[model samples]
Target: MRKNPVATKAPAEQVVKDIRRAMRKLHSSEEKIRIVLSGLRGEDSIAELCRKEGIAQSLYYSWSKDFLEAGKKRLAGDTARQASTGEV
Candidate 1:
């Protein structure tokens, strides 16, 4: 008789990966900005802040980079608008 592959339980590693993926946290834009701003304040070491926030240093750095780039783009847009208004 042929065995049913689908009826069998998943492998331990696959089960663990599935659980982790399901349990992953989703951060809101506001939450991300707050965290980035906190890191920028320099009240605590980046490593310490990450540890307290229950996140990795790489994740913190990624958020920080995104936040700064967005601000820079917004400021540039504002400046261009101001110059155009002045010309008119």
Candidate 2:
């Protein structure tokens, strides 16, 4: 009797890790800003927004906090000065 090579499989942990990595979503900065702004609009509850966007409430809050802090810094003109030369 010949063994079937097709029946071979990777370890369960490795398979799970691969599946999780594949399922992970990479959102662009624009998309992140949009989501944060939407949450701030108050048109919907934060929990509901998170649910609709498939993110955790905590993640939404973290993004919101970062967005607000950035705006605050910008309004306060606390931005760092850019180097005049592009050369390293």
Candidate 3:
């Protein structure tokens, strides 16, 4: 294990910013879906993905539910509009 000198420690503000940057990279539903899907393809384990991405499995499930619900709503809206407008 490598140890850093206490005198050369990074500032708290910089540490916080770096942590936020890492999270921000995975801060979108599309990104989450891609990560989850890629994991499904055996590139990595779901637990590993969650760990590396700094997310909980529950959060991943919630995002999946939200994505499915959003797609359903969009499809329903499109169907209603097409029925009213006779737009096939």
Model 3 clashing residue pairs (backbone):
none
The residue ranges of model 3 lying beyond 4 angstroms of the native Cα positions read: 1-26, 39-44, 78-88
Better of 2 and 3 by lDDT: 2
What lDDT score belongs to each candidate, Candidate 1 first?
0.87, 0.86, 0.72
Q: Write the per-residue lDDT of candidate 2 for residues 1-88, one digit (tens) a residue.
A: 8766555545666789999999998878798899998987889999898999998898888888988999999999999867777753
Q: What would the TM-scores of all predictions be?
A: 0.75, 0.73, 0.44
Off by over 4 Å in 2: 1-10, 81-88
lDDT of 3: 0.72
* Model 3 worst lDDT run, 10 consecutive residues: 79-88
Best by TM-score: 1
1-88 per-residue lDDT for model 1 (tens digits): 9787766646766899999999988999988998999999999999999999888999999999998888898878854444466677
What lDDT is reached at residue 40 by model 3? 59
Clashing pairs in 1: none
Worst 10 residues of 2 by lDDT: 4-13
Model 1 clash tally, residue pairs: 0
lDDT by residue (13-36, candidate 3, tens digit) is 689888888875447656877865
**Number of the top-ranking candidate, with lDDT as the measure:** 1
